[model samples]
Target: MTVTEAEGDTAAQAPMGSSSYSRFDTDWLSDATLALFATGGTSPLFATSSTVEVRYLGTQATREASLSFQGPALFDTRSGCNFATALVDEFCLIDSIGTARTLGDLATGTTLDFTLTAQPQPLGSPIDQRASAESFSSLASARWIDLGGGQYLLGFEEGNDASYNDMVFLVSGATATLPSPALPVPELPTGWLLAAGLAALAWRHHTRR
Candidate 1:
């Protein structure tokens, strides 16, 4: 099926750092929603079941982002599932804001690989840009936030802005099999270390005196 705008009269607003021509209009998500899920943790996600449900949460992107999926360990065979035919091939589930769609039940043990294709601009010679969770080279393009209870919040950064709020989705029956980004270790500055060393030497000299 083709992607179409959701029903309802909605107003469009330009996302931050985007031109007027690029507008997103939807109410399913807001800044608070993004903040709530921002710290939920991120990692490469997989479908726990063949029957996965997806809901278009919202978008804050300049380009038109569409959702699709391929499955049964097609992207990463090392994920461990037996080789099976792709459950879905580039199906357009959501192409606009506030739309929700579900994929038909797939074979059990099928690991899902989600993709988001950025449609070409209406006025320019831009070509379709695609990003997938299976592509480790550009893993930053897609992020999966575990929402717990077999649900997840998937977001895509369709452009260089790195605002994953571009195309947000609420997915059910998914889990993160990979580790999330770890917090950086804290370390003292070189000046602090030098001062500590000098203080220790002074203390020793005082004791000897």
Candidate 2:
């Protein structure tokens, strides 16, 4: 069973430092949906076109601009360029050890794209170690993007594996009330039965009149 930390386990509870240097973490945010498919033994493969929006609630400390959240945990793992930052907007982080890096220099779009070959040195080191299973597996292929407006939509699925490709845009907005167990929605036809019947009744009454 792939165990997760207790509910209260977060950057808030750890003895972390200001946004100064890079800090490694075992936990990075994965789409709650992905966590389900990629359970302890089952790794969910992100398809091309699978996108999600994320929100970042700013953090402050002692009235100083202390960067919060586990930034490097996600920033270091950018296999094949897994994320992008918007133009005019840059990806910045102050690690627990006071390592600060920006993604603005890496991408050329309002939003950047992922290219395994086009990764930054500092950003690539942690990811490499993780993927090799030589370091914190958490850092392996797991870097966070600067979700614009504090949120982003990340889509990169293309029919199961990496064969049939589409741009899974990492757009932002929309939160799943419950992230686990990807929720199902009623098909349009199935859900419209009542509305369709109501419309039919009104039409019949009008004809009778």
Candidate 3:
């Protein structure tokens, strides 16, 4: 997932290392499950870093899907930045029409096509002397929760804290959509450099507490 400027601008052409976007695709492993493909990318001057992961617990079949994001970086070195990792300015979820949709049931092994996007709050001011301050979604993971009927809950990781209250999506029928809520593009100081590798593999550390 390479970082790109808002409004379909790539990071290479951006004026400064601020907001960006990326897109990824994955497949469905179950009737009610969508494997959120893992991806990681960096911005110029290493100003922003991002990683995502989603998987299923059981077996099933489906087709390829896509997800996108349009917001500031989640990991930043500017603690004093304005919109850095604020959530309110960021948003990410299954991108679809309307507010809600359905995905049938998992027990029946009914696969469906869909798309999801992850967005964070708007970009904040550049980092200041507060270099020690760091903001990040290290635990940016997601899972599916059965809500009975054709509705399902899509939960995502949030904050540095070990909590699952970050974001949720409800699928009611064959389609599922989530409202763009407040997302934060937190700024964090650089410390240990993560070993470079595949996008999905590089982000495993971010999942750890």
Candidate 4:
């Protein structure tokens, strides 16, 4: 889905570094919080430095998921930046929380592609599902959020539930350029707007029950 900017002279572009929206509650991290472009298309993350750090934030899914990267210099064995050494073949694991890994020798200003795979549990189907940043086959499986300062939040939706909170990670030294259009900022704090949206969702869910 394309996110278009507003028309007319009053439309202002979001700042380059920080997200257009406000900070989300920490509790939302444990649950399926709203993502800026949850149902829309995502852009590739570009490396800002020769080396980028990826930290496992946390996962709320029951599936055994693994995160991997694919890029021009990522798996090049000749550059000594092979998948096994330069990049962690399995950078983040479902059970390995709060762990961080560095991807070295990445070419600056280039896209760093990512793939998230969800392993089948004993009780679930035996098929392994995959989501990719460069592929549109599973567009809803992955979501990217700019957290400013060359940091981004990447989330994946492993199951059909549409909760992109299955696997969440923080990537530093990388940036993603979204195609969203400029929006008019209201007088209220951006955080309050985000909170109000969440409150509405919660209230709707509560009433349904």
In the range 6-62, model 2's lDDT, one tens digit per residue, is 222112111122222211222333234232322221122221122322211221111
Candidate 3 vs candidate 4, lDDT winner: 4
lDDT of each: 0.49, 0.25, 0.26, 0.49
User: What RMSD value applies to candidate 1?
Assistant: 16.8
Candidate 2 has an lDDT of: 0.25
Off by over 4 Å in 4: 1-41, 71-95, 124-140, 178-209
Backbone clash count for every predicted candidate, in the order shown: 0, 41, 40, 1
Q: Over the stretch 100-176, how does candidate 1's per-residue lDDT look in tens digits?
A: 45555555444556666554434322432333222221144666666689887777666565556556677777677
Kindly list the per-residue Cα lDDT of model 4 for residues 1-209, writing each as its tens digit: 11122221211111111221111224224223344436523767777767777665554443344566652211110121111221243222222334456777666665666666554444323332233222212243677777679877777666666656555666788866532434777598889999999999999999999
TM-score of 2: 0.19
- RMSD to true structure for each model, in Å: 16.8, 16.6, 25.2, 22.8
Worst 10 residues of 4 by lDDT: 73-82
Model 3 Cα shift for residue 81 (angstroms) = 18
State, as a TM-score between 0 and 1, how close model 4 is to the true structure.
Answer: 0.49
Q: Clashing pairs in model 4?
A: 5-181
